[model samples]
Target: MTANPRGPNAVDRHVGSRIRLRRQLLNLSQEKLGEELGVTFQQVQKYERGTNRVGAGRLWNLARVLDVPVSFFYDGVNEGAGQPGFSEGDQTPIVDDFIQSADGVALAQAFARIKDSKVRRRILELVRTLAAEEAEATATEAAS
Candidate 1:
C-alpha cells in the first residue's frame, strides 16, 4: 500500500487482510463482528483497513468472535514477510497462497464440522502431518 514506512504497518495490512477475509468467509458484517468484539462497525472497518493497529487483547476477542486461532492472523506473515529489502518476489504471502486453493476452502469446511472436540483436534494434527509429508515428498521428487 505505497510503502508503509517499514514497521507494523506492513504487518497491519497482512493482519487486516486476514481479518477481512476471514470475516467475509464467515459472512459476517462489520457490525456483527464489532458487536461480538464489543466495538463499533467503524472500529472493525478501521482494523480491516489497517488504519489502526489490532491490540493483543482485542485480537483475542476477535479470535473468539471469528472462531479462529490467534495464530491464524500471523500464519502467512513469516520470515518471508521480513525481507530486508522488500521486492515483488516477497509480494505474495503464505496466507495469499492458502486463500487461492480449493483445499483451503475444504479445510475450512472440515473445521466447521467435527462436532467432537477431540475429533477436531485429531483431524488438525493428522492433516498437518499429512500435508507436511506430502510437501516433503514433492520437494524430494522435484530435486530428483
Candidate 2:
C-alpha cells in the first residue's frame, strides 16, 4: 500500500479515479455528464479531483444521470488502510494504476460543496475498505 497518509483525503482521490474510470467505461464525456447534471464541465472536474465533496443529494442526482448506483462511486476503496493508508502487502499495481481522468475530475468538482465531515469520512471508510478487499482478492487469484 502507499506510504502516504491513508484517510479521508486519499479516499477522495480514489473516488475521483473511480468516477473517471466509470465515465470511461460508459464512454461519456465530461460536458455531457455536466449537461445532464445541470452543471458546468469545470464543476465536474472538481468533483473527480476530490477537490469537491459530493453530498447525498447531488450524488443521487449524479447516479441517476450516469445510470449507475450511488454505491458505484464508493466502489474499490479499501478499509484496511486506515489513516496510514496501504501497508506493504496491500500495495499493488492496481491501486497505483487508478487514475483520475480530466473529465472525471470535472465530475467530482460538481459535488465539492458537501460540507458534512461525518458523511464524507464515513463514505471514505466504506469505499476504501471495499477497494482494498477487492484488490487483495484479485491479487490472490492472479498469484494462484
Model 2 ranges with Cα > 4 A deviation: 1-8, 80-144
Q: lDDT by residue for model 2 over 1-144, one digit each (tens)? A: 454343336566666666667676567888988898888888888877777666688888887877889888877667753345354354534433633444544445533566788977776799789999999999999999
Best by TM-score: 1
Number of the predicted model whose lDDT against the real structure is largest: 1
Residue 16's C-alpha lDDT in candidate 2?
65
Q: Rate the local accuracy (lDDT) of all candidates.
A: 0.79, 0.69
Candidate 1: tens digits of C-alpha lDDT, residues 26-113: 8788999998888999999899878888999999988888899999987667465535465425568575766634577557776887
